[model samples]
Target: MFIKIPLHISGLWYPIITNNPLTTGSIGAGINIALYLTAKLRNTEKCGILLNNEEVLKDHSRAICGKLGVNLSVDEKSPISLGYGFGLSAACLLGLSLSSLLVKNITIEKATWPAHVAEVIYNTGYGDVIAEFYGGLEIRVKPGPPGIGVVEHIYPGRKVDLIVSVLPGREDTPSMLKRIGKETYDLARKLIDELLEKPSVEEFFVKAHVFTSKIFSYDNIDKLLSPYRSKIIGYFRKKQALVLWVENEWLDEIYSYLNKYFLSFKTWIDMYGVRFENTS
Candidate 1:
Protein backbone atom coordinates (compact mmCIF):
# COMPACT_ATOMS: atom_id res chain seq x y z
CA MET A 1 0.00 0.00 0.00
CA PHE A 2 1.06 3.60 -0.60
CA ILE A 3 0.03 7.02 0.69
CA LYS A 4 1.20 10.58 0.10
CA ILE A 5 1.09 13.60 2.46
CA PRO A 6 1.83 17.26 1.82
CA LEU A 7 4.06 19.54 3.94
CA HIS A 8 4.07 23.11 5.37
CA ILE A 9 6.47 26.02 5.72
CA SER A 10 7.21 27.30 9.23
CA GLY A 11 7.06 31.02 8.74
CA LEU A 12 7.58 34.17 10.79
CA TRP A 13 6.28 33.72 14.33
CA TYR A 14 7.27 33.61 17.94
CA PRO A 15 9.10 30.80 19.64
CA ILE A 16 7.47 29.94 22.98
CA ILE A 17 10.15 27.79 24.66
CA THR A 18 11.20 28.34 28.26
CA ASN A 19 12.14 26.75 31.58
CA ASN A 20 8.83 27.79 33.10
CA PRO A 21 6.59 24.82 33.72
CA LEU A 22 3.45 26.87 33.23
CA THR A 23 4.17 27.99 29.66
CA THR A 24 4.85 25.83 26.63
CA GLY A 25 6.99 26.97 23.69
CA SER A 26 5.19 26.81 20.37
CA ILE A 27 5.60 28.30 16.86
CA GLY A 28 3.21 30.83 15.43
CA ALA A 29 1.58 30.26 12.02
CA GLY A 30 3.31 31.09 8.76
CA ILE A 31 2.49 30.03 5.22
CA ASN A 32 2.02 26.47 4.03
CA ILE A 33 4.19 26.04 0.94
CA ALA A 34 4.11 23.24 -1.61
CA LEU A 35 6.15 20.22 -0.52
CA TYR A 36 5.15 16.59 -0.15
CA LEU A 37 5.71 13.18 1.37
CA THR A 38 4.72 9.93 -0.32
CA ALA A 39 4.89 6.76 1.75
CA LYS A 40 5.13 3.28 0.27
CA LEU A 41 4.59 0.33 2.52
CA ARG A 42 6.17 -3.02 1.90
CA ASN A 43 5.91 -6.45 3.54
CA THR A 44 8.99 -6.09 5.71
CA GLU A 45 8.97 -4.96 9.32
CA LYS A 46 10.94 -1.73 9.07
CA CYS A 47 10.46 1.98 8.37
CA GLY A 48 12.65 4.56 6.61
CA ILE A 49 12.75 7.87 4.70
CA LEU A 50 14.38 9.21 1.54
CA LEU A 51 15.00 12.85 0.64
CA ASN A 52 14.94 13.28 -3.08
CA ASN A 53 16.39 9.74 -3.47
CA GLU A 54 18.96 9.38 -0.69
CA GLU A 55 18.10 7.43 2.49
CA VAL A 56 18.04 9.23 5.85
CA LEU A 57 17.26 8.57 9.50
CA LYS A 58 14.04 6.77 10.37
CA ASP A 59 13.86 7.54 14.09
CA HIS A 60 10.73 9.71 13.83
CA SER A 61 8.90 7.17 11.71
CA ARG A 62 10.02 4.40 14.01
CA ALA A 63 8.68 6.29 17.00
CA ILE A 64 5.25 6.55 15.40
CA CYS A 65 5.26 2.85 14.53
CA GLY A 66 6.27 1.93 18.06
CA LYS A 67 3.37 3.90 19.47
CA LEU A 68 0.87 2.42 17.02
CA GLY A 69 2.20 -1.16 17.36
CA VAL A 70 2.43 -1.60 13.64
CA ASN A 71 5.60 -2.37 11.69
CA LEU A 72 5.99 -2.26 7.95
CA SER A 73 8.68 -1.22 5.52
CA VAL A 74 8.10 2.38 4.56
CA ASP A 75 9.64 4.74 2.04
CA GLU A 76 9.05 8.48 2.36
CA LYS A 77 10.09 11.11 -0.17
CA SER A 78 10.29 14.91 -0.03
CA PRO A 79 11.66 17.75 -2.16
CA ILE A 80 12.27 20.19 0.70
CA SER A 81 15.42 20.06 2.78
CA LEU A 82 15.06 18.58 6.25
CA GLY A 83 16.30 21.32 8.58
CA TYR A 84 15.42 24.50 6.73
CA GLY A 85 12.29 25.45 8.68
CA PHE A 86 10.19 23.84 5.96
CA GLY A 87 8.73 21.25 8.35
CA LEU A 88 9.84 18.37 6.12
CA SER A 89 10.67 16.17 9.09
CA ALA A 90 7.32 16.79 10.72
CA ALA A 91 5.61 16.12 7.44
CA CYS A 92 7.36 12.77 7.09
CA LEU A 93 6.44 11.60 10.55
CA LEU A 94 2.88 12.86 10.19
CA GLY A 95 2.55 11.29 6.77
CA LEU A 96 3.52 7.90 8.13
CA SER A 97 1.17 8.26 11.06
CA LEU A 98 -1.68 9.40 8.85
CA SER A 99 -1.09 6.46 6.54
CA SER A 100 -1.20 4.15 9.50
CA LEU A 101 -4.49 5.68 10.54
CA LEU A 102 -6.06 4.97 7.17
CA VAL A 103 -4.57 1.52 6.78
CA LYS A 104 -5.17 0.42 10.37
CA ASN A 105 -8.50 2.22 10.87
CA ILE A 106 -7.23 4.33 13.75
CA THR A 107 -8.62 7.75 14.61
CA ILE A 108 -6.81 10.78 13.16
CA GLU A 109 -6.36 12.40 16.54
CA LYS A 110 -4.82 9.24 17.89
CA ALA A 111 -2.66 8.67 14.83
CA THR A 112 -1.27 12.20 14.82
CA TRP A 113 -0.40 12.17 18.49
CA PRO A 114 2.74 10.12 18.02
CA ALA A 115 3.96 12.35 15.22
CA HIS A 116 3.50 15.43 17.37
CA VAL A 117 5.16 13.72 20.30
CA ALA A 118 8.09 12.62 18.16
CA GLU A 119 8.71 16.17 17.01
CA VAL A 120 8.61 17.51 20.54
CA ILE A 121 10.77 14.71 21.90
CA TYR A 122 13.42 15.15 19.23
CA ASN A 123 13.27 18.94 19.20
CA THR A 124 12.51 18.76 15.51
CA GLY A 125 9.71 21.34 15.81
CA TYR A 126 7.14 22.71 18.22
CA GLY A 127 4.05 23.57 16.12
CA ASP A 128 4.75 22.42 12.56
CA VAL A 129 2.78 19.21 13.04
CA ILE A 130 -0.25 21.03 14.32
CA ALA A 131 -0.05 23.75 11.67
CA GLU A 132 0.46 21.23 8.88
CA PHE A 133 -2.50 19.30 10.19
CA TYR A 134 -4.75 22.34 9.79
CA GLY A 135 -3.16 23.85 6.59
CA GLY A 136 -3.46 27.29 4.93
CA LEU A 137 -2.24 30.50 6.60
CA GLU A 138 -2.35 29.26 10.22
CA ILE A 139 -1.84 30.97 13.53
CA ARG A 140 -1.23 28.80 16.57
CA VAL A 141 -2.94 30.64 19.40
CA LYS A 142 -1.97 28.16 22.08
CA PRO A 143 0.69 25.48 22.30
CA GLY A 144 0.86 21.91 23.52
CA PRO A 145 0.49 18.57 21.85
CA PRO A 146 -1.73 18.30 18.78
CA GLY A 147 -4.96 17.84 20.74
CA ILE A 148 -3.78 20.42 23.23
CA GLY A 149 -2.67 23.07 20.71
CA VAL A 150 -5.08 25.59 19.20
CA VAL A 151 -4.75 27.06 15.67
CA GLU A 152 -6.64 29.62 13.54
CA HIS A 153 -6.02 30.57 9.90
CA ILE A 154 -7.22 32.67 6.96
CA TYR A 155 -7.74 31.55 3.39
CA PRO A 156 -5.78 33.61 0.87
CA GLY A 157 -8.65 35.46 -0.81
CA ARG A 158 -6.51 35.77 -3.91
CA LYS A 159 -3.56 33.96 -5.46
CA VAL A 160 -0.21 34.72 -3.83
CA ASP A 161 3.25 33.71 -5.00
CA LEU A 162 6.19 32.57 -2.83
CA ILE A 163 9.83 32.16 -3.76
CA VAL A 164 11.90 29.96 -1.47
CA SER A 165 15.70 30.18 -1.74
CA VAL A 166 17.60 27.38 -0.04
CA LEU A 167 21.21 28.00 0.96
CA PRO A 168 23.86 25.30 0.78
CA GLY A 169 23.40 23.90 4.32
CA ARG A 170 20.86 23.09 7.01
CA GLU A 171 20.16 24.80 10.35
CA ASP A 172 20.22 22.82 13.56
CA THR A 173 16.88 23.79 15.08
CA PRO A 174 17.63 22.38 18.52
CA SER A 175 20.86 24.31 18.69
CA MET A 176 19.16 27.45 17.43
CA LEU A 177 16.47 27.08 20.09
CA LYS A 178 19.10 27.30 22.82
CA ARG A 179 20.19 30.74 21.60
CA ILE A 180 16.62 32.11 21.51
CA GLY A 181 15.61 34.02 24.63
CA LYS A 182 12.28 35.04 26.08
CA GLU A 183 12.54 38.52 24.55
CA THR A 184 12.52 36.97 21.06
CA TYR A 185 9.40 35.07 21.93
CA ASP A 186 7.81 38.21 23.34
CA LEU A 187 8.41 40.18 20.16
CA ALA A 188 7.04 37.37 18.02
CA ARG A 189 3.92 37.16 20.15
CA LYS A 190 3.41 40.88 19.95
CA LEU A 191 3.73 40.98 16.17
CA ILE A 192 1.53 37.93 15.63
CA ASP A 193 -1.21 39.40 17.79
CA GLU A 194 -1.08 42.62 15.82
CA LEU A 195 -1.26 40.64 12.57
CA LEU A 196 -4.26 38.60 13.71
CA GLU A 197 -6.23 41.79 14.31
CA LYS A 198 -6.32 42.37 10.56
CA PRO A 199 -5.30 39.34 8.55
CA SER A 200 -4.34 39.82 4.94
CA VAL A 201 -1.59 38.37 2.74
CA GLU A 202 0.16 41.75 2.50
CA GLU A 203 0.11 42.20 6.24
CA PHE A 204 1.43 38.70 6.71
CA PHE A 205 4.46 39.39 4.53
CA VAL A 206 5.15 42.67 6.20
CA LYS A 207 4.93 41.23 9.69
CA ALA A 208 6.94 38.16 8.79
CA HIS A 209 9.72 40.26 7.32
CA VAL A 210 9.78 42.44 10.38
CA PHE A 211 9.84 39.49 12.74
CA THR A 212 12.60 37.76 10.80
CA SER A 213 14.74 40.89 10.72
CA LYS A 214 14.28 41.59 14.41
CA ILE A 215 15.24 38.05 15.46
CA PHE A 216 17.83 37.01 12.88
CA SER A 217 20.91 38.83 11.64
CA TYR A 218 21.36 39.98 8.12
CA ASP A 219 23.39 37.58 5.99
CA ASN A 220 25.03 37.61 2.58
CA ILE A 221 21.79 36.39 1.04
CA ASP A 222 20.13 39.56 2.27
CA LYS A 223 22.77 41.62 0.55
CA LEU A 224 22.45 39.67 -2.68
CA LEU A 225 18.73 40.27 -2.90
CA SER A 226 18.92 43.90 -1.85
CA PRO A 227 18.87 45.11 -5.43
CA TYR A 228 15.31 43.92 -5.96
CA ARG A 229 14.06 45.02 -2.55
CA SER A 230 11.57 47.43 -3.98
CA LYS A 231 9.86 44.90 -6.23
CA ILE A 232 9.55 42.12 -3.65
CA ILE A 233 6.95 42.50 -0.95
CA GLY A 234 9.35 41.34 1.76
CA TYR A 235 12.09 38.79 2.38
CA PHE A 236 12.70 36.78 5.53
CA ARG A 237 15.51 34.55 6.63
CA LYS A 238 14.18 31.08 7.49
CA LYS A 239 16.43 28.76 9.43
CA GLN A 240 19.52 28.66 7.17
CA ALA A 241 17.51 29.63 4.11
CA LEU A 242 15.49 32.59 2.86
CA VAL A 243 11.93 33.00 1.53
CA LEU A 244 10.59 35.96 -0.42
CA TRP A 245 6.98 36.95 -0.90
CA VAL A 246 6.25 38.42 -4.30
CA GLU A 247 3.16 39.61 -6.06
CA ASN A 248 1.88 37.03 -8.53
CA GLU A 249 2.47 39.31 -11.46
CA TRP A 250 6.10 39.86 -10.50
CA LEU A 251 7.03 36.17 -10.17
CA ASP A 252 8.55 35.83 -13.60
CA GLU A 253 10.79 38.85 -13.34
CA ILE A 254 11.88 38.00 -9.81
CA TYR A 255 12.57 34.41 -10.73
CA SER A 256 14.61 35.45 -13.70
CA TYR A 257 16.62 37.90 -11.65
CA LEU A 258 17.28 35.67 -8.61
CA ASN A 259 17.54 32.20 -10.13
CA LYS A 260 21.29 32.45 -10.63
CA TYR A 261 22.11 33.31 -7.01
CA PHE A 262 20.80 30.21 -5.26
CA LEU A 263 18.65 27.13 -5.58
CA SER A 264 15.13 28.54 -5.76
CA PHE A 265 11.58 27.59 -6.62
CA LYS A 266 8.21 29.31 -6.89
CA THR A 267 5.20 27.80 -5.10
CA TRP A 268 1.81 28.90 -3.87
CA ILE A 269 0.09 28.51 -0.52
CA ASP A 270 -1.27 25.03 0.23
CA MET A 271 -4.76 25.50 1.64
CA TYR A 272 -5.32 21.79 2.14
CA GLY A 273 -3.23 20.17 4.80
CA VAL A 274 -1.92 16.65 4.41
CA ARG A 275 -3.60 14.50 1.72
CA PHE A 276 -3.58 10.76 1.12
CA GLU A 277 -3.52 8.61 -2.01
CA ASN A 278 -3.47 4.89 -2.22
CA THR A 279 -1.48 3.18 -4.99
CA SER A 280 -1.50 -0.50 -4.59
Candidate 2:
Protein backbone atom coordinates (compact mmCIF):
# COMPACT_ATOMS: atom_id res chain seq x y z
CA MET A 1 0.00 0.00 0.00
CA PHE A 2 1.05 3.60 -0.51
CA ILE A 3 0.68 6.75 1.63
CA LYS A 4 0.46 10.21 0.16
CA ILE A 5 1.98 13.35 1.74
CA PRO A 6 1.47 17.01 0.88
CA LEU A 7 4.27 19.03 -0.76
CA HIS A 8 5.04 22.73 -0.19
CA ILE A 9 7.02 25.75 -1.39
CA SER A 10 8.15 28.54 0.94
CA GLY A 11 7.06 31.87 -0.56
CA LEU A 12 9.55 33.84 1.51
CA TRP A 13 11.74 32.93 4.50
CA TYR A 14 14.71 33.82 6.60
CA PRO A 15 16.54 30.93 8.20
CA ILE A 16 17.02 30.82 11.96
CA ILE A 17 20.11 28.68 12.26
CA THR A 18 21.17 27.46 15.65
CA ASN A 19 23.39 24.71 17.09
CA ASN A 20 20.36 22.72 18.12
CA PRO A 21 18.13 21.18 15.49
CA LEU A 22 15.09 21.51 17.76
CA THR A 23 15.54 25.28 17.66
CA THR A 24 16.63 25.49 14.04
CA GLY A 25 13.97 26.65 11.58
CA SER A 26 13.05 29.63 9.43
CA ILE A 27 10.89 32.68 9.93
CA GLY A 28 8.80 32.80 6.76
CA ALA A 29 5.57 32.09 4.90
CA GLY A 30 4.65 29.26 2.51
CA ILE A 31 1.79 27.63 0.63
CA ASN A 32 0.98 23.92 0.66
CA ILE A 33 0.56 22.91 -2.96
CA ALA A 34 -1.72 20.02 -3.87
CA LEU A 35 1.26 17.99 -5.06
CA TYR A 36 2.12 14.96 -2.92
CA LEU A 37 4.40 11.96 -2.62
CA THR A 38 3.15 8.41 -2.91
CA ALA A 39 5.17 6.19 -0.55
CA LYS A 40 4.71 2.43 -0.63
CA LEU A 41 5.04 0.90 2.81
CA ARG A 42 5.20 -2.52 4.50
CA ASN A 43 6.14 -4.19 7.75
CA THR A 44 9.74 -5.33 8.08
CA GLU A 45 12.35 -6.06 10.73
CA LYS A 46 14.84 -3.64 9.28
CA CYS A 47 14.32 -0.19 7.80
CA GLY A 48 14.97 0.28 4.08
CA ILE A 49 14.72 3.41 1.97
CA LEU A 50 13.93 2.80 -1.70
CA LEU A 51 13.78 6.49 -2.43
CA ASN A 52 14.54 8.12 -5.75
CA ASN A 53 13.48 4.81 -7.25
CA GLU A 54 16.55 3.21 -5.63
CA GLU A 55 18.78 5.45 -7.75
CA VAL A 56 19.74 8.04 -5.14
CA LEU A 57 19.27 9.15 -1.50
CA LYS A 58 20.39 5.72 -0.37
CA ASP A 59 22.57 7.08 2.43
CA HIS A 60 20.31 9.93 3.48
CA SER A 61 17.22 7.75 3.48
CA ARG A 62 18.97 4.99 5.38
CA ALA A 63 20.11 7.41 8.05
CA ILE A 64 16.58 8.80 8.43
CA CYS A 65 15.16 5.27 8.53
CA GLY A 66 17.65 4.20 11.17
CA LYS A 67 16.19 6.88 13.38
CA LEU A 68 12.56 6.08 12.52
CA GLY A 69 12.76 2.25 12.42
CA VAL A 70 10.47 1.15 9.57
CA ASN A 71 10.70 0.28 5.86
CA LEU A 72 9.70 2.60 3.01
CA SER A 73 9.65 2.34 -0.79
CA VAL A 74 9.39 5.75 -2.41
CA ASP A 75 7.32 5.81 -5.59
CA GLU A 76 8.59 8.03 -8.38
CA LYS A 77 5.06 9.16 -9.27
CA SER A 78 5.55 12.30 -7.14
CA PRO A 79 7.61 14.50 -9.40
CA ILE A 80 8.84 17.42 -7.30
CA SER A 81 12.09 18.50 -8.97
CA LEU A 82 14.87 18.77 -6.42
CA GLY A 83 16.76 22.03 -5.72
CA TYR A 84 14.17 24.17 -7.46
CA GLY A 85 12.78 25.22 -4.05
CA PHE A 86 9.90 22.72 -3.96
CA GLY A 87 11.00 21.64 -0.44
CA LEU A 88 11.53 18.05 -1.64
CA SER A 89 14.11 17.00 0.94
CA ALA A 90 11.85 17.72 3.89
CA ALA A 91 8.87 16.29 2.03
CA CYS A 92 10.71 13.02 1.47
CA LEU A 93 11.75 12.82 5.09
CA LEU A 94 8.16 13.42 6.27
CA GLY A 95 6.87 10.90 3.72
CA LEU A 96 9.40 8.34 4.85
CA SER A 97 8.65 8.90 8.52
CA LEU A 98 4.87 8.80 8.05
CA SER A 99 5.09 5.59 6.05
CA SER A 100 7.41 4.00 8.57
CA LEU A 101 5.25 5.00 11.52
CA LEU A 102 2.07 3.81 9.84
CA VAL A 103 3.45 0.29 9.53
CA LYS A 104 4.67 0.34 13.14
CA ASN A 105 1.40 1.63 14.66
CA ILE A 106 3.11 4.66 16.15
CA THR A 107 1.73 8.16 16.56
CA ILE A 108 2.62 10.59 13.77
CA GLU A 109 3.87 12.97 16.47
CA LYS A 110 7.09 10.95 16.60
CA ALA A 111 7.63 11.56 12.90
CA THR A 112 8.66 15.24 12.66
CA TRP A 113 11.83 15.47 14.74
CA PRO A 114 13.68 12.77 12.86
CA ALA A 115 12.93 14.44 9.54
CA HIS A 116 13.54 17.93 10.95
CA VAL A 117 16.80 16.90 12.63
CA ALA A 118 17.97 15.31 9.40
CA GLU A 119 17.27 18.48 7.47
CA VAL A 120 19.20 20.55 9.99
CA ILE A 121 22.19 18.21 10.11
CA TYR A 122 22.29 17.88 6.34
CA ASN A 123 21.66 21.62 5.87
CA THR A 124 18.94 20.81 3.38
CA GLY A 125 16.04 23.02 4.58
CA TYR A 126 14.58 25.15 7.33
CA GLY A 127 10.93 25.81 8.26
CA ASP A 128 9.78 23.51 5.44
CA VAL A 129 9.10 20.35 7.43
CA ILE A 130 7.07 22.11 10.09
CA ALA A 131 5.28 24.38 7.63
CA GLU A 132 4.56 21.53 5.24
CA PHE A 133 3.41 19.41 8.16
CA TYR A 134 0.88 22.07 9.13
CA GLY A 135 -0.39 23.00 5.62
CA GLY A 136 -2.02 26.25 4.40
CA LEU A 137 -0.44 29.71 4.12
CA GLU A 138 1.55 30.68 7.23
CA ILE A 139 3.78 33.35 8.64
CA ARG A 140 6.24 31.40 10.80
CA VAL A 141 7.15 33.84 13.54
CA LYS A 142 9.27 31.54 15.64
CA PRO A 143 12.04 29.22 14.55
CA GLY A 144 12.34 25.49 15.31
CA PRO A 145 10.29 22.31 15.03
CA PRO A 146 6.47 22.30 15.16
CA GLY A 147 5.88 22.48 18.92
CA ILE A 148 8.86 24.74 19.39
CA GLY A 149 8.13 27.15 16.55
CA VAL A 150 5.16 29.50 16.26
CA VAL A 151 3.20 30.21 13.08
CA GLU A 152 0.24 32.46 12.27
CA HIS A 153 -2.00 31.50 9.36
CA ILE A 154 -3.11 34.01 6.69
CA TYR A 155 -6.61 33.44 5.44
CA PRO A 156 -6.75 35.06 2.00
CA GLY A 157 -10.51 35.40 2.61
CA ARG A 158 -10.90 33.29 -0.55
CA LYS A 159 -9.17 30.25 -1.96
CA VAL A 160 -6.42 30.77 -4.54
CA ASP A 161 -4.23 28.69 -6.82
CA LEU A 162 -0.45 28.28 -6.92
CA ILE A 163 1.77 28.32 -10.02
CA VAL A 164 5.34 27.07 -9.97
CA SER A 165 7.94 27.87 -12.63
CA VAL A 166 11.37 26.36 -12.12
CA LEU A 167 14.26 28.16 -13.72
CA PRO A 168 16.89 26.63 -16.03
CA GLY A 169 19.43 25.57 -13.40
CA ARG A 170 19.06 24.33 -9.82
CA GLU A 171 20.58 26.20 -6.91
CA ASP A 172 22.26 24.25 -4.13
CA THR A 173 20.28 24.88 -0.94
CA PRO A 174 23.19 24.39 1.44
CA SER A 175 25.33 26.75 -0.55
CA MET A 176 22.54 29.28 -0.73
CA LEU A 177 22.02 29.12 3.03
CA LYS A 178 25.73 29.62 3.60
CA ARG A 179 25.86 32.61 1.29
CA ILE A 180 23.07 34.48 3.10
CA GLY A 181 24.80 37.36 4.86
CA LYS A 182 24.03 38.84 8.26
CA GLU A 183 22.79 42.02 6.63
CA THR A 184 20.21 40.05 4.71
CA TYR A 185 19.09 38.21 7.81
CA ASP A 186 18.86 41.49 9.66
CA LEU A 187 16.83 42.98 6.86
CA ALA A 188 14.59 39.91 6.82
CA ARG A 189 14.03 40.14 10.58
CA LYS A 190 12.75 43.68 10.15
CA LEU A 191 10.67 42.58 7.18
CA ILE A 192 9.13 39.87 9.32
CA ASP A 193 8.04 42.53 11.79
CA GLU A 194 6.56 44.55 8.97
CA LEU A 195 4.79 41.48 7.62
CA LEU A 196 3.27 40.81 11.03
CA GLU A 197 1.69 44.25 11.16
CA LYS A 198 -0.81 43.85 8.33
CA PRO A 199 -0.01 40.35 7.15
CA SER A 200 -2.26 39.51 4.26
CA VAL A 201 -1.51 36.98 1.52
CA GLU A 202 -1.02 39.84 -0.95
CA GLU A 203 1.37 41.71 1.36
CA PHE A 204 3.46 38.56 1.72
CA PHE A 205 4.19 38.44 -2.01
CA VAL A 206 5.03 42.11 -2.16
CA LYS A 207 7.42 42.04 0.81
CA ALA A 208 8.76 38.65 -0.15
CA HIS A 209 9.58 39.91 -3.62
CA VAL A 210 11.58 42.64 -1.99
CA PHE A 211 13.69 40.06 -0.21
CA THR A 212 14.04 38.06 -3.44
CA SER A 213 15.25 41.13 -5.29
CA LYS A 214 17.76 41.90 -2.56
CA ILE A 215 19.57 38.58 -2.91
CA PHE A 216 19.12 37.25 -6.43
CA SER A 217 19.42 38.81 -9.88
CA TYR A 218 15.66 38.72 -10.43
CA ASP A 219 15.59 41.29 -13.22
CA ASN A 220 15.03 38.74 -15.97
CA ILE A 221 12.02 37.00 -14.44
CA ASP A 222 10.83 40.30 -12.99
CA LYS A 223 10.50 41.68 -16.51
CA LEU A 224 8.83 38.51 -17.75
CA LEU A 225 6.32 38.80 -14.92
CA SER A 226 5.59 42.49 -15.48
CA PRO A 227 2.80 42.21 -18.02
CA TYR A 228 1.05 39.45 -16.08
CA ARG A 229 1.57 41.01 -12.67
CA SER A 230 -1.59 43.06 -12.83
CA LYS A 231 -3.63 40.11 -14.01
CA ILE A 232 -2.39 37.85 -11.17
CA ILE A 233 -2.38 38.25 -7.42
CA GLY A 234 1.37 38.27 -6.63
CA TYR A 235 4.58 36.27 -6.85
CA PHE A 236 7.90 35.62 -5.10
CA ARG A 237 11.08 33.68 -5.70
CA LYS A 238 13.07 31.01 -3.94
CA LYS A 239 16.40 31.16 -5.73
CA GLN A 240 15.70 30.36 -9.40
CA ALA A 241 12.13 29.18 -8.88
CA LEU A 242 9.09 31.46 -9.07
CA VAL A 243 5.71 30.74 -7.38
CA LEU A 244 2.69 32.76 -8.46
CA TRP A 245 -0.61 32.97 -6.61
CA VAL A 246 -3.72 33.70 -8.65
CA GLU A 247 -7.48 33.83 -8.41
CA ASN A 248 -9.43 30.95 -9.95
CA GLU A 249 -10.89 33.21 -12.63
CA TRP A 250 -7.43 34.27 -13.81
CA LEU A 251 -5.96 30.75 -13.97
CA ASP A 252 -6.45 30.30 -17.72
CA GLU A 253 -5.17 33.76 -18.62
CA ILE A 254 -2.12 33.44 -16.35
CA TYR A 255 -1.14 30.07 -17.79
CA SER A 256 -1.56 31.32 -21.33
CA TYR A 257 0.56 34.38 -20.63
CA LEU A 258 3.34 32.42 -18.95
CA ASN A 259 3.39 29.89 -21.79
CA LYS A 260 5.32 32.37 -23.88
CA TYR A 261 7.94 32.87 -21.17
CA PHE A 262 8.11 29.82 -18.89
CA LEU A 263 6.90 26.30 -18.28
CA SER A 264 4.54 26.38 -15.32
CA PHE A 265 2.45 23.97 -13.27
CA LYS A 266 -0.84 24.63 -11.44
CA THR A 267 -2.27 23.54 -8.07
CA TRP A 268 -4.54 25.15 -5.52
CA ILE A 269 -3.76 25.91 -1.90
CA ASP A 270 -4.04 22.89 0.38
CA MET A 271 -5.45 23.91 3.75
CA TYR A 272 -4.71 20.51 5.23
CA GLY A 273 -1.12 19.68 5.96
CA VAL A 274 0.55 16.29 5.61
CA ARG A 275 -1.58 13.41 6.85
CA PHE A 276 -2.54 9.83 6.03
CA GLU A 277 -4.24 10.25 2.65
CA ASN A 278 -5.04 6.58 1.99
CA THR A 279 -3.53 3.12 1.61
CA SER A 280 -4.22 0.98 -1.40
The candidate scoring highest on lDDT is 2
Model 2, position 64, has a per-residue lDDT of 75
Candidate 2 per-residue C-alpha lDDT over 188-257 given as tens digits, one digit per residue, 9 for 90 to 100: 8787788889888888888887877777777787688776766677888887667888767788877777
Angstrom error of the Cα, residue 216, model 2: value is: 1.9
Stretches of model 2 off by over 4 angstroms after superposition: 42-54
Which candidate number has the best TM-score? 2
TM-score of each model, in listed order: 0.88, 0.89
**Model 2 steric clash pairs:** none
Among all windows of 10 consecutive residues in model 2, the one with the lowest summed lDDT is: 42-51
Give the per-residue Cα lDDT of candidate 2 at 272: 79
* Global lDDT scores for all candidate models: 0.71, 0.74
The pairs that clash in candidate 1 are 16-25, 17-25
Q: What is the overall TM-score of model 2 with all chains considered together?
A: 0.89
